[model samples]
Target: MSTLTDRYVWAAVRSIPEKQRGELEPELRGLIADTTDAQREKGVSDADIERATLLELGDPVRLAAGYTERPLQLIGPRYYLDWLRLLKLLLVIVVPIAALGAALGRLLSGGDVGDVFGALFVTAIGVAVHLSFWVTLVFALVERGGVQRIKTPGDGPLLEWTPDSLPQLPAPAARRQSLVELILGLVFLAVFAGWFVWQQFNSFLTDADGTPIPVLEPALWSGWMYWFLGLIVLEGVFAVWVYQRGRMTMGLATLNLFMNIAFTVPAVWLLLTGQLINQEFLDAIPDTDADFDTAMSYALPVIAFIVIGVAVWDVIDGYIKAWRSRNVSDTAGE
Candidate 1:
């Protein structure tokens, strides 16, 4: 047993943007309440009034279409270029990484040529599907809910529907996103993620005799790796932000300071616990004078000190750049 009101609301909003849903839902409820009240005052049965009110509102799909632009199209013209650019960007980042992974997996498993090609094809298709689904979803939402910016008041509320009015080029230098920086950041993220996954799921690199040597201590896998991985992700965010803004803002600088401190603490723990280098790895060094503990006791602390110093410098660097940029802006304004 379902109320006409509940069914209508769900149907209407199922296509709405998530952010707009809350506001739209309340407005819809208010409208329904008012309509139902008027019908009740006319001495109509509750069930009959509800049906009549809903019927007046008409099909939910058509009603919802009124709320958002391009309801029928997967992606509207306004968002099509951005959608295409993002799709290309995703393919650029993901395809190579997926191809590399497939090739490496095949090589490690001693796969034949046919198997290698098959794996590559499978991975490429999988990556493209994943990229397409997400990118299309985001662009469809944009078509529904994204702002229609008008640089001039002469322009109509809805853009004068024309391909010529669509944005052709990017913003000017210093304001535009850095393509080189973005590509580098993406490449770094891809490499880091791939390496971390390898560390988590597979054995370490093998020696000449195919002996699987472990690079990290067993202690690391317990919990510290998560902390390290989190910092890497945080750093990746900073990288992306830099690419987006073409420079760091005061907010980003502040975050950098906090992240540096947060990252350093766990890193220091790894060094202090002698978990920085595996004991077996230390032993593998031919004619090593110092044992695992001995080497760690002296060398590890120096490395830790260097790491801390570098982190402090990074914090200082971020703040200095932020301050300089702020000062430049203030001076230019004057």
Candidate 2:
């Protein structure tokens, strides 16, 4: 009872292995050609064949989906293994560099550089020796998907991939990006730390009380804040890279969310308490305390606002990643 066009399309599907049929989509043109040839030979009209083929193929939207690979995510397949490799490489390179820099910085600043560097170098070598042990342990944990065996039904024990499967390996592509990001992050952290240390040291050499720190006029502080905020934004972007690479474990992800929440929760509590006491400024500083308390009240909110803003961005990123992961699961199911 099958029409020529129906048989033609079936033949195409039949020629493809069920498992790989999803990858052979756009090549289905031959099916139409074969159907046309058969219809011509039988003297069946072209119009009839076209109508029959359209009906046999069902909806194009649904058919097209059958030919595509399921999405792989949480960390996407392309980047998961890469992220793992990156983390390892970063630990090896950055830790030593940071240690050496710290030592050099101390020595340069009159703080026992040689002794500290020597001790740190020796400790690093020890770490390298034991590196394999730790690497193997981490690898084993990743392979196990960070979970114990689950109970299953029937005659034998079973292990299987499931929707809730944890990401253990870093995608190779993501690992490369992570390495680049790590290098940049270290460079930024180093520069900032060095400047900070130097500033503090200079401040110490001068009179005490920190010379009132020149109350950074609006233009100066605003410019500095712009750069600082930019750095924070960059860090947030890199965190997304990790999330996309599936480097975020549920425990770590929750902790990240919790820390952000904690940073903001105090602000809300202060407002509530301040309103309750009907006091404009709480604990109105006892000594020259008035000046100190006033400074803190002004400074605290600004710092808190920056922290909360960054934290909110991080939370949004986590949610986005979680959503993408769920979609990947659904695609795999399909």
Report every candidate's CA lDDT. Answer: 0.63, 0.47
Per-model TM-score, in order, reads: 0.43, 0.32
Give the deviation of candidate 2 from the true structure as CA RMSD. Answer: 16.3
How much is 138 displaced in model 1, in angstroms?
A: 33
Residues 255-301 of candidate 1: C-alpha lDDT, one tens digit per residue: 67666765686568667776656666666666777574576568878
Backbone clash pairs for candidate 1 read none
Candidate whose TM-score is highest: 1
Model 2 lDDT, residue 247, Cα:
52
Scored by lDDT, the top model is: 1
* Predicted structure 2, TM vs. truth: 0.32
Q: Write the per-residue lDDT of candidate 2 for residues 1-334, one digit (tens) a residue.
A: 2333332344345434577555454356665566557766877776666654444453332233345544323333333333345546645464555544554455446554245446456655666556645655654555446443345332111332221232233346766876776667667756754553344334222224434222222232323333334444545564655544555443334445644543344334344334212131133224536687677677666666776787789787666656655454444323
Candidate 2 whole-model C-alpha lDDT, 0 to 1: 0.47
